[model samples]
Target: MATHHKADQPTLRSLTKRQWIRIASVVAVVGLVVAGGAATRSIYSHANAAPTAEPTAYSISDAHAASRGNARDALEGEPTYVNVTINGKTRTVLGTNFTDVKSVLDAGDITLESGDTVEPSLKTKVDESTTITISRAGAKMETEESKIPFNTVKKETSSLPKGTEKVETEGQEGILEKTNLVERSGDKIISSNTFASWVKKAPVEKVILVGTAEQQPQTTTDTSNNSSSSNSNANNNAQSASNNVGTTAPVGEMQQWAHDYLLANGGTEADFTATVYIISHESGWSVSATNPGSGAYGLPQALPGSKMASHGADWATNYQTQLKWFWDYCKSRYGSVQGAYSFWQANHWY
Candidate 1:
């Protein structure tokens, strides 16, 4: 009994190892629960904390400028995803390493054709918000038709009375066909120019006759008895010319006019008769008569009609003008109206 250890030391040593382990485990569990609760409280506190006041708002113009700057910054930044529209369909382009719109199009496997156009030029830098558009060719060659104006030709002649004017041929407009290279968008024409041109129908030139005939001296009727008989006798002598002349004076205004005109101009009654016959067969004395098949015109029915213009520009409408032309042609070609009539009787044309 005298050799015993200290009491405290013995007490500790008496406790079992299992018992000590159990106590330590209990303490550890309690500590974990308490720590978990404290962590949750800390999180709740931070969530409820008051936020700091926001910075003052910028002006509208300043805000716009800032937005623009941001856009510019984004465009110059790293590779981004962009949108590309060819025709009307849209698709996203993965601009992985693209720097500009052109590069973006290349990445999208898109191509441009002749006269094709793009919005936001190919040289512009691309960004996530950038959209590239491709439009089809806008220019094409087309045929166009329009009117061509006719020309007018004037000639001086003695067929009409002095100081008179007459239109021998009416003017006609012609067709002008052209090849036009036109630039258009949809239905709108932006620009155009004629590349080639041709006349579909040649224009008919208008011929005008201006008279140059000298005025005849007017005879004053002498109410005096002595001159009245003289004047009557003189008038009879003028048209009849000679009792020996074989042809009779024609009746009617136009016919009598022809008769007097021929005789006064050094023509025979036979010449007047030949003229009436040829003119009657050819045109019935109508100044505007036209031959559809041969393109002949006027009283003389001259082919191409323009030949009548040599005698008078009024050849198309004036009977006197056409008659004069006919007389001139007869004299030049057949020696006289009688000769033309002789030829016409056999050939049926003169």
Candidate 2:
């Protein structure tokens, strides 16, 4: 076997002084580097970590000031309040900075229907306290059926005796279909106009025959006539004349008076014709005529019968006085008889 010799391991004491000094310097440098690295990590952790100390509190006065400023700004941005009435119901709404009435209503989601009306115009400006009123109106077409009255015609016959009348034909009412345009506003009818009308049935006119024949007295020969008989016949004739005058005084007097007065007051035959037409419908040319329903009297149908007293004290019995007052009224109010007739034709009254 080869000679086994034990080699000695190097020890610190066996190492040279210069090698030991170099080893010691290396250990010192490593220690210094580890300590500096630990110190730098501590500083970086302190700089980045969240604060743990109790937070400082602001003064109550400073906090209230900031809160008040925010509240003021919010209040200034708010809109103004206004009252709005639509279809009889009132409600509150914000104006939302709108300037005109239309804009304000639009902001409230209010829509207007056809023919609706606004108290203030849509283009009118709105204020803070302005009250908007809306009138709801609508128009629609409606159809209705009505009756038309028939007319009566008169004919005179000399063959029949006086005061005798005969009906030649019967009268009948006619049917008419009328179309109306109806306008309404808030439960009230604003207007109803007849847009079209059609006659469904024609009216039958009544024909009447009047008697005008007079009876003649029988005549005898005068061979037996004596003075006493002659005197008695004259007395009888005078009594008959007086009776005729008393009976004829009230009959046909008003029509005759109206005719005479109209001719004297710068009125022509045309005026007399219109006057007769009106009087025929009003009071039938009777001075003592009185309307039971309206309390109207006289040929002109004056209301209360006292209106005719303005003419004369004898207006109740005298047809001439009533006619004079009627003529003056017609001239001053209607300018002419024809004008009055025109109005009567439209409204059924003058």
Q: Each model's RMSD to truth, in Å?
A: 37.4, 39.0
Task: Give the clashing residue pairs of candidate 1, or none.
Answer: none
Model 1 C-alpha lDDT per residue in residues 117-209, reported as the tens digit of each score: 899999998776678877665556687766644445455555557799788678686564555556787889987643333344444545566
For each candidate, give its TM-score against the true structure: 0.30, 0.29
Name the TM-score of candidate 1. Answer: 0.30
The local distance difference test score of model 2 is 0.56
Tens-place lDDT per residue, model 2, 1-350, is 79663567666668999999999999999999999999999999999999643211111112111111121121224445455665554544443366888876665445666767897899998875678887655666677876645545555555457889777669776665555557777788887644333344544546565666687575785746576886786576444432221101111445556656666867665576567555555544446543322224566655334456678988766877777777776777789766776666555566
The C-alpha lDDT values of all candidates are: 0.58, 0.56
Residue range with the least summed lDDT across 10 consecutive positions in model 1: 59-68
Q: How many backbone clashes does candidate 1 have?
A: 0
